[model samples]
Target: MTIRVVAKNYVKPEKVQDFLGLCKSLVEVSLKDEGCIDYGLYQELENSGVLTFLEEWKDEKSLDQHLNSSHFKEIFPLLSEYLEKETEVNVYRKTL
Candidate 1:
Protein backbone atom coordinates (compact mmCIF):
# COMPACT_ATOMS: atom_id res chain seq x y z
CA MET A 1 0.00 0.00 0.00
CA THR A 2 1.09 3.54 -0.55
CA ILE A 3 2.00 5.70 2.40
CA ARG A 4 1.87 9.42 2.98
CA VAL A 5 4.16 11.29 5.30
CA VAL A 6 3.65 14.73 6.74
CA ALA A 7 6.26 16.62 8.69
CA LYS A 8 5.50 19.95 10.32
CA ASN A 9 8.38 22.12 11.38
CA TYR A 10 8.21 25.17 13.56
CA VAL A 11 11.24 27.20 12.61
CA LYS A 12 12.94 29.87 14.60
CA PRO A 13 12.07 33.28 13.16
CA GLU A 14 15.62 34.09 12.22
CA LYS A 15 16.26 30.73 10.65
CA VAL A 16 13.32 30.43 8.27
CA GLN A 17 15.32 31.27 5.15
CA ASP A 18 18.16 28.94 6.10
CA PHE A 19 15.68 26.20 6.92
CA LEU A 20 14.04 26.66 3.53
CA GLY A 21 17.35 26.47 1.72
CA LEU A 22 18.16 23.18 3.38
CA CYS A 23 14.72 21.78 2.67
CA LYS A 24 15.01 22.77 -1.00
CA SER A 25 18.13 20.65 -1.27
CA LEU A 26 16.52 17.79 0.58
CA VAL A 27 13.40 17.88 -1.64
CA GLU A 28 15.40 18.07 -4.83
CA VAL A 29 17.28 14.90 -3.99
CA SER A 30 14.45 12.98 -2.36
CA LEU A 31 12.27 13.37 -5.44
CA LYS A 32 14.81 11.48 -7.49
CA ASP A 33 14.91 8.48 -5.20
CA GLU A 34 13.24 5.27 -6.26
CA GLY A 35 9.77 4.67 -4.83
CA CYS A 36 9.31 8.29 -4.03
CA ILE A 37 5.92 9.05 -5.51
CA ASP A 38 5.94 12.71 -4.56
CA TYR A 39 7.66 15.27 -2.33
CA GLY A 40 6.86 18.88 -1.60
CA LEU A 41 7.26 21.62 0.94
CA TYR A 42 4.76 24.25 1.97
CA GLN A 43 4.43 27.11 4.40
CA GLU A 44 1.27 27.95 6.31
CA LEU A 45 -0.43 31.04 4.93
CA GLU A 46 -1.25 32.31 8.37
CA ASN A 47 1.90 31.20 10.09
CA SER A 48 5.13 31.79 8.24
CA GLY A 49 7.10 29.97 10.89
CA VAL A 50 5.27 26.74 10.21
CA LEU A 51 6.65 24.77 7.29
CA THR A 52 5.43 21.39 6.20
CA PHE A 53 6.72 18.60 4.05
CA LEU A 54 4.17 16.40 2.32
CA GLU A 55 5.48 13.18 0.87
CA GLU A 56 4.13 10.09 -0.79
CA TRP A 57 6.00 6.83 -0.94
CA LYS A 58 5.34 3.55 -2.74
CA ASP A 59 5.24 1.67 0.57
CA GLU A 60 6.65 1.39 4.05
CA LYS A 61 9.82 -0.14 2.68
CA SER A 62 10.31 2.77 0.32
CA LEU A 63 9.81 5.18 3.16
CA ASP A 64 12.31 3.27 5.24
CA GLN A 65 14.84 3.52 2.46
CA HIS A 66 14.32 7.24 2.30
CA LEU A 67 14.81 7.59 6.03
CA ASN A 68 18.14 5.82 5.75
CA SER A 69 19.33 7.69 2.67
CA SER A 70 22.65 9.51 2.97
CA HIS A 71 21.17 12.91 2.19
CA PHE A 72 18.53 12.43 4.84
CA LYS A 73 21.14 11.35 7.34
CA GLU A 74 23.23 14.42 6.62
CA ILE A 75 20.42 16.97 6.44
CA PHE A 76 18.01 15.87 9.13
CA PRO A 77 20.25 16.52 12.10
CA LEU A 78 21.03 20.00 10.88
CA LEU A 79 17.33 20.81 10.87
CA SER A 80 17.25 20.91 14.66
CA GLU A 81 19.42 23.96 14.67
CA TYR A 82 16.76 25.95 12.84
CA LEU A 83 13.71 24.67 14.64
CA GLU A 84 12.02 26.32 17.57
CA LYS A 85 10.69 22.96 18.72
CA GLU A 86 10.86 19.36 17.63
CA THR A 87 9.34 18.58 14.25
CA GLU A 88 6.11 16.61 14.12
CA VAL A 89 5.99 13.77 11.61
CA ASN A 90 3.16 11.41 10.90
CA VAL A 91 2.72 8.56 8.48
CA TYR A 92 -0.58 7.38 7.06
CA ARG A 93 -1.62 4.40 4.99
CA LYS A 94 -4.35 4.70 2.43
CA THR A 95 -7.66 3.42 3.74
CA LEU A 96 -9.44 2.99 0.47
Candidate 2:
Protein backbone atom coordinates (compact mmCIF):
# COMPACT_ATOMS: atom_id res chain seq x y z
CA MET A 1 0.00 0.00 0.00
CA THR A 2 1.08 3.54 -0.63
CA ILE A 3 1.84 5.39 2.58
CA ARG A 4 1.16 9.06 3.11
CA VAL A 5 2.41 11.27 5.90
CA VAL A 6 1.28 14.70 6.98
CA ALA A 7 3.80 16.08 9.41
CA LYS A 8 3.49 19.44 11.12
CA ASN A 9 6.15 21.28 13.03
CA TYR A 10 6.05 24.66 14.69
CA VAL A 11 9.50 26.18 14.64
CA LYS A 12 10.97 28.89 16.82
CA PRO A 13 10.98 32.28 15.14
CA GLU A 14 14.72 32.55 15.61
CA LYS A 15 15.49 29.20 13.92
CA VAL A 16 13.18 29.54 10.95
CA GLN A 17 15.93 30.36 8.48
CA ASP A 18 18.17 27.58 9.67
CA PHE A 19 15.27 25.16 9.63
CA LEU A 20 14.49 26.09 6.04
CA GLY A 21 18.07 25.47 4.97
CA LEU A 22 18.16 22.11 6.70
CA CYS A 23 14.80 21.18 5.23
CA LYS A 24 16.08 21.96 1.77
CA SER A 25 19.01 19.63 2.23
CA LEU A 26 16.85 16.92 3.78
CA VAL A 27 14.31 17.12 0.96
CA GLU A 28 17.02 16.95 -1.64
CA VAL A 29 18.49 13.82 -0.16
CA SER A 30 15.19 12.12 0.59
CA LEU A 31 14.00 12.52 -2.99
CA LYS A 32 16.88 10.37 -4.19
CA ASP A 33 16.24 7.53 -1.78
CA GLU A 34 14.67 4.30 -2.96
CA GLY A 35 10.86 4.18 -2.87
CA CYS A 36 10.44 7.85 -2.14
CA ILE A 37 7.50 8.63 -4.37
CA ASP A 38 6.96 12.19 -3.21
CA TYR A 39 8.08 14.66 -0.56
CA GLY A 40 7.70 18.37 0.06
CA LEU A 41 8.07 20.92 2.84
CA TYR A 42 5.65 23.80 3.01
CA GLN A 43 5.17 26.78 5.30
CA GLU A 44 1.74 28.02 6.29
CA LEU A 45 0.82 31.38 4.85
CA GLU A 46 -1.14 32.47 7.89
CA ASN A 47 1.50 31.17 10.28
CA SER A 48 4.98 31.28 8.84
CA GLY A 49 6.38 29.46 11.81
CA VAL A 50 4.43 26.33 10.97
CA LEU A 51 5.99 23.86 8.55
CA THR A 52 4.17 20.92 7.07
CA PHE A 53 5.73 17.96 5.35
CA LEU A 54 3.75 16.11 2.73
CA GLU A 55 5.27 12.76 1.91
CA GLU A 56 4.43 9.54 0.13
CA TRP A 57 6.27 6.25 0.05
CA LYS A 58 5.85 2.93 -1.70
CA ASP A 59 5.00 1.12 1.52
CA GLU A 60 5.55 0.89 5.26
CA LYS A 61 9.00 -0.56 4.66
CA SER A 62 10.00 2.41 2.57
CA LEU A 63 8.85 4.80 5.25
CA ASP A 64 10.79 2.82 7.82
CA GLN A 65 13.89 3.00 5.67
CA HIS A 66 13.47 6.74 5.40
CA LEU A 67 13.14 7.14 9.14
CA ASN A 68 16.49 5.39 9.55
CA SER A 69 18.13 7.34 6.75
CA SER A 70 20.97 9.68 7.43
CA HIS A 71 19.05 12.57 5.91
CA PHE A 72 16.34 12.10 8.51
CA LYS A 73 18.72 11.75 11.43
CA GLU A 74 20.92 14.68 10.47
CA ILE A 75 18.25 17.36 10.28
CA PHE A 76 15.22 16.23 12.26
CA PRO A 77 16.78 16.20 15.75
CA LEU A 78 18.22 19.65 15.22
CA LEU A 79 14.92 20.86 13.90
CA SER A 80 13.20 19.28 16.87
CA GLU A 81 15.14 21.50 19.24
CA TYR A 82 13.67 24.59 17.59
CA LEU A 83 10.18 23.21 17.64
CA GLU A 84 7.54 24.65 19.97
CA LYS A 85 6.71 21.08 20.96
CA GLU A 86 7.04 17.58 19.59
CA THR A 87 6.23 17.27 15.91
CA GLU A 88 2.77 16.15 14.90
CA VAL A 89 2.50 13.40 12.28
CA ASN A 90 -0.45 11.68 10.68
CA VAL A 91 0.09 8.53 8.66
CA TYR A 92 -2.39 7.11 6.20
CA ARG A 93 -2.70 4.26 3.76
CA LYS A 94 -4.84 4.22 0.66
CA THR A 95 -7.86 1.94 0.81
CA LEU A 96 -9.10 2.42 -2.71
Candidate maximizing TM-score: 1
lDDT of 2 by residue, 20-43 (tens): 988998999999889999999989
What is the C-alpha lDDT profile of model 1 across 2-78, one tens digit per residue? 99999999999899999999998999999998899999999999999999999999999999999999999999999
Clashing pairs in 2: none
Task: Show model 2 residue runs off by greater than 4 Å.
Answer: none
RMSD of 1: 0.8
Worst 10 residues of 2 by lDDT: 73-82
Overall lDDT per candidate, in order of appearance: 0.95, 0.92
